[model samples]
Target chain A: DTAVSQTPKYLVTQMGNDKSIKCEQNLGHDTMYWYKQDSKKFLKIMFSYNNKELIINETVPNRFSPKSPDKAHLNLHINSLELGDSAVYFCASSQEASGRTDTQYFGPGTRLTVL
Target chain B: AQSVAQPEDQVNVAEGNPLTVKCTYSVSGNPYLFWYVQYPNRGLQFLLKYITGDNLVKGSYGFEAEFNKSQTSFHLKKPSALVSDSALYFCAAKTGANNLFFGTGTRLTVIP
Candidate 1:
């Protein structure tokens, strides 16, 4: 079974459109995170949720929002997508909190294209 | 604040040869350093991590990383290169906070 899985492996949409990416993990990890990999291949943390509580919110645009209904799922919703939003988004989860020793498991990633 | 740096943008190696991907970091307090690999069109796969106790840590696919506290460096190395090993490698650090910082990433190309 896949540890972490995201739906819609590929997404293509036009500007001003809204989209949502779904993620789920079976590893029983407490913290789930969303990362954006831009065209330059730089992965930056967007949001992190631990047990449905918002932990970290980086300097991301308001168009992006994350919702975790439960510990096993974290979904990303992007509103009014822009051309610059074309990139790959990944979902990851880790076991613990407050430290760096926790190893994160990542999903297959969803490639988003704003045309 | 925690940060990671990947000095090389790309590393090319021939199959059966050894390869190294350099990574360094800056963080407050002890660091939990990690190496991850990403194949094209895929997300990242955790390779190995250093959480103290020892200087070297080994992970899947025969990849290993050495963590140096004085130099604040964690480099990924492998004894033999394979075409399948060609992928993007990322180095990251976890500070005292829950957030993890990632380097830009180094692209590895293993020629057969």
Candidate 2:
């Protein structure tokens, strides 16, 4: 069984376009996170949700919003996508109590290209 | 703020040669270090971690990392390199709030 999964492996769109990347996990985890890896290969945490509750929101812009409808899903939506927003986004999940701690299982990333 | 550093952007090694990728971190209180590997067009895979006890931690694919508290360094090392090992490696640290900060990845190219 796949622990974590994300939709739309590759996305290419023009500027000013709005898009959404969906993520899901079947590991029965409580904590889910989103990370962005830029072209320079610098990966940074963007958001983390614990049991459908927002826990950490980094210095991400207001244009980017993360929605967690439930414990097993975390979706990222970006408005007015700019060239600078082009990067690979990853979704990960971890168990909170005994199933998860400091260790997170990642999903196959979704690459977004803003032209 | 907690941070992790990978000094080398890329490292090259022969197939049979030993390889080392250096990483350092800064965090308050005890630190939890982790290493992950990412191949082309793939998500990162967790390799190993250091939470408590045993400075030397072994991970998948015959990979191991040594944690040096004095230097705040956690260097990944392998006795021998394989051509299939070519990938980008990231070093991450959990310093505070149980948050993970990843280093600028190090690309390892094992030449045949």
- Identify the runs in model 2 with alpha carbons over 4 angstroms from their true place: A97-101
Ten-residue segment with the worst summed lDDT in candidate 2 chain A? A93-102
Listed in order, each prediction's TM-score against the native is 0.96, 0.95
Error of 1 at A18 (Å): 1.1
Compared with the true structure, model 1 gives a TM-score of: 0.96
- C-alpha positional error of residue A3 in candidate 1 after TM-score superposition, expressed in Å: 0.8
Q: What's the TM for chain B in candidate 1? A: 0.96
Count of clashes, each model: 0, 1
Show the lowest summed lDDT stretch of 10 residues, model 2 chain B.
B92-101
lDDT tens readout by residue for model 2, B1-112:
7789999999999999999999999888888899999999999999999887999999999999999999999999999999999999999987545657799999999999
TM (chain A) per model: 0.94, 0.91
TM-score of 2: 0.95
Best by DockQ: 1
